[model samples]
Target: MALRITDECINCDVCEPQCPNTAISMGPEHYIIDPDRCTECVGHFDEPQCQVFCPVECIEVDPDHTEDRETLEAKFRRLAVS
Candidate 1:
């Protein structure tokens, strides 16, 4: 599933550059992830880099935009192709 940053985020900017899919972006309130672009690093890394780098542990699976691993991989593949 795609990951999202919560309001608890400290805005430390630690997770931004760590996202393999470049899905994380600065938001009006907190760092945000584009679900369409996020693959939880399935096609890029062994784990979610954002979650790893976030010192506040505010990154979590996006419940509102839940997706299976296969779907995430498909999205990754599509992004790679284009």
Candidate 2:
């Protein structure tokens, strides 16, 4: 699943640099994650990098964008190949 920054986000910019896929970006209100680029850190890390670094715990899985492990892996693979 892709993570979404909550309104609780402080816009600290801490999470931006932590994303290996460059999925996270600045928003007018808060940081945003591009779902097309988000692999939940599967291709690059053992865990979600953004979740680990978000100071306010604002990063959480988007239930609406949920995907199985295989799908997530495939998504990462596609990104890698591209």
Candidate 3:
């Protein structure tokens, strides 16, 4: 599943650079994750880098944009070639 930044985010700017797919971006109020570009780091790492580095633990799976591991891996591959 794709991850999302919650309102609990402190806007620390730590999670943005950690995303392998470059899915995290600064939104109007806080950081936001693009579900289209998010792959949960399946192809890049064993775990999600953003979540690992996030100090406040505000990143969580996006329930509304849920996806399986295989789908995330496919997305990662697509991102790699593009």
Candidate 4:
């Protein structure tokens, strides 16, 4: 599943740089995760880097954009080629 930034985000600026896919960006209020680019760090790490680094634990799985590991891996591979 892709991850999302919640309103609880403190705008700590930690999550943006941690995203290997460059999916996190500053939104109107807090950081937002682009589902199209989010791979949950599958191609880069065993765990999601942004969630690990978010100080407030505001990052969570996006229920509306859920994807299995295989799908995430495919997306990661596609991203790698581009």
Per-candidate clashes, comma-separated: 0, 0, 0, 0
lDDT of each candidate versus the true structure? 0.88, 0.89, 0.93, 0.95
Q: Pick the candidate with the highest TM-score.
A: 4
Top candidate (lDDT) = 4
Show model 3 residue runs off by greater than 4 Å: none
What are the runs in model 1 whose C-alpha is more than 4 Å off? none
Give a tens-digit lDDT track for model 4, residues 7-79: 9999989999999999999999999999999999998998999999988999999999989999999999999
Model 1, range 1-82, lDDT digits (tens) per residue? Answer: 7888889998898988988778888899888999989999998988999888788899999888889889988999998987
TM-score of each: 0.93, 0.94, 0.97, 0.98
Candidate ranking (lDDT, best to worst): 4, 3, 2, 1
lDDT (Cα, tens digit) per residue for candidate 3, span 16-52 = 9998888999999999999999999898899999999
Residues 1-82, candidate 2: write the lDDT tens digits. Answer: 8878889999888999999889999888888999888999997999998999887899999987988889989999999888
**Residue pairs with backbone atoms closer than 3 Å in model 1 (clashes):** none
- Which parts of model 4 have CA positions greater than 4 angstroms off? none
Which is the winner by TM-score between candidate 3 and candidate 4? 4
TM-score, candidate number 1: 0.93
